[model samples]
Target: MQVAYDYEYQLAVADYWQGRPTMEPNVWVPSLPLQMTVAVPASNTDLVVSSGGQQELKLAVMEESTEYQHERSNPMEDFEKAARAFEDDLQKMQTKMHLFPPSMKGEELSKYSEPKVVSIGPYHHGKGEAIPQMESTKYAAACHFINESGRSVEEVYGAVFAVADEARRCYDADKLRLLSDNDFKPMMFYDGCFLLQYMLFMCRDNNDEDHPIADLPWVVVDKLMKLMPKPGLDMETFVGRVKQCLQTRRHLKFDPPILDESYKPPHLLGLLRFYIVGSTDSSTTDDGSGQGLSDNAKKVSLSVSVIELAEMGIRLTADKTTAEINKMRVTRGWFTGKLFLPPVSLDDANARFLVNMAAFELCITPDFGEVDDTMSTVCAYLCLLGMVTDNDTDVQELRKKHILQGGGLTNEDALELFTGLEKHLRPGNCYYNTIVAIENYRSDRRLWIKLYRFGYRNQTAIIAVLTTIAGIAGFLGTLKSFQ
Candidate 1:
């Protein structure tokens, strides 16, 4: 810790004898590792910077990139501002509008990937609740990335279900029931997403029962029937890729194994068109990049009935613009001078909300229903707000496709953050109705059938006889007392 005074004297003498250039005082002193009692400025010059915990030293010369800094435009800041604007506008316009309906169209909507649906294997270890727990920075980054990137139409997204499967759980019993039902897959756009089943578990009344629906009948997308070859990697291989991400700070070398194009779902196109491509901030910016779309944009929706393939459904309707689409039909060897107009006029914001809601419904279908109270309330709002269509196949398909398995927040997350979830001071948060739904489900007949199933007939008859005898005895006693 102690430095000899002779060292400083020797250095001064050497500098004088050699007639060497003076060393910059601001540069780190060679006396750095020493302990100091009386504080001496590191630099002889007034301008100095503070060292780790020591006094700032003065330096006439500075190292590169040390002092001056440059300013750069933050694309993320721009995106966040835009997103906030959108949220504000939507809240102002959509607050009072009902978005979820109790009962929606229930007809079987067709799918483009019909032939290739694969049944998830029995060994499928369902995942936990997929509640997004992103911090502010991460949220901004995700929003920025999504807003700036191009949509990928055919790629299957990967979302590992946690053991709790929080993605799909709702607070309403009816919604929970609808979601957990095995037969509801057809209601969804795809055979439901990764945590679709698990969300059902999260939304279930766990407090009342271990509500993961203990006995499940595995009904899956029949992929083998659809002509798609299986991915070479199984769960073990997929886990290995996950391991790589954990092992290194960089991106994993292993990419998701590509599946055959033949088996890709047609809904994937619509997914890309709307979710991935539709709302990007950069796309709408005037960058001459063909990234932005007009406020009003329409996506093509295709539907085929499992019961009747000929009865096809398309999300787009025929209107004057239809003529425009027809005008460009020369490639099909068809001459069309008319325009292709959509039935729903997307010029207005309300119309866009309606269409987007419809698309959401189509994609989110039988995928979620009979959900928990919280989720049920959300779905109900979607209906009450008129975002979802009335009871029918096409309408039902839309609900299944869009809303139920809503990805970002699972039922538990909704419950945990239930107090803080709403960012606004507006009334009628979807959570209120969810509680009502839970109370209602508790009284349902099925809740106690198992426990009271023992000797039902005999017990009922005996109670009935005892009640009659007691009534007669009371009548006789009253008469005697009157006498």
Candidate 2:
């Protein structure tokens, strides 16, 4: 007779487990009786056994098979234990990092979130072929940045390698799991060098002959593109990418680079973010801000749009009236508010730079559909502008007032700048106070009284009323004469 060993064994185990009403002293009792039995036909062979001998053979087979099972399970048991321990440790580390993964809100937002000219860290590494135009230039830029300081590339590489572990922890596990130190260190060093050198060129008023990147034809073209705005361009391609790098270099000037050894940014992008948003002052520095999100700073009330506040007798003026263009300060009066936005040169590149930074904030800030009160000030400000400027009319108003300088973008395209970013923001409740004040002033009964008094106070109303009555009388007299 044929025997189905696996099927029979499974059936025996199922019966044992399912039929048990009480605890057994030995769970292995079922396996003790289990053994494969086979019989040769009596006509075909002389190997037929008597009942007594067959019974003896079955017992012996059971003992040997049970011992084999025990031996095989020992190592498997150890492996399972090790796997459980490893998983626990991974979970703990993940909890410690608190990193929120970057989400693809949509194709439009995703385009802004991803790096164009350069890929910084693990999240986007190897996702596509390197941009042929930039790959060679990036390596050249790295060489220049390292050699310009009379330092070897190894020195920069070593510095980055030393902190590779810390850098890896900055990203979510899924993006980073396949990344090893060998793949990561080179990318970080190269990207860092490119960014630092780019910043150096931007901060300088003139590109000297010895400027590491000045001689590059690409660099010349990049600088030219920033100064000249293209008309009829609707999407970001060559022009947009170049502008983003330039704008970032420009914005970085406000915060400046902090080169102190104590400040260890998690990665190149994190380093860029530090200069843009993190304070250099020790008193304001965020210590133990956790691995994931930045802490709460404070929230200010949202301001009214330029046109609305103007109608309310508020004078809108640029606060950075001085030569320094990087200073962003907002000043307000009871009836007059001056919004000091540094001369913002709006283009696809500037828009992309702002949006990506805001995306970074959304990813790192702790929230449940709302931005943390302590979110990055830069992001909050950008979001406020995005919230107010919803369409072409708003863009035209801001541009007309010199509040926004549209680089190459038309009014409709300019709306995409802040409006697209608004999709993934949690503007906290801090800036409502200003709006509340404006609403209260608009609803006040005293405001109408003031308007009435101003009109009648100088007998301007009496002169207007008498002039109207005389004009009507003259017209009536003329009609009677004609009749």
lDDT of each: 0.26, 0.45
lDDT score of model 1? 0.26
For model 2, give the 10-residue run with minimal summed lDDT.
Answer: 208-217
Q: What is the C-alpha RMSD of each candidate to the true structure, in Å?
A: 27.0, 20.3
lDDT of 2 by residue, 1-483 (tens): 232211222212233345545533321222223233346544422344676766222223234576666665578889999999877655444113222334536555665554555554445543445533455555666666545555433344445555556555545567567654545555555555555556556444433111121111122222222322344112122212233343312433333232445654333334344444433221111121211222232222345664554454444444343222223333334444344443456655555555654555555555523543334544555655675586788777777666676465788666765676556565532223223434443334246535544544646768888899999999999999999
Residue 379 deviation, candidate 1, in Å? 17
Worst ten in a row by lDDT for model 1: 324-333
What tens digits encode model 1's per-residue C-alpha lDDT throughout 297-317? 232112112221111111211
Native-vs-model 2 lDDT? 0.45
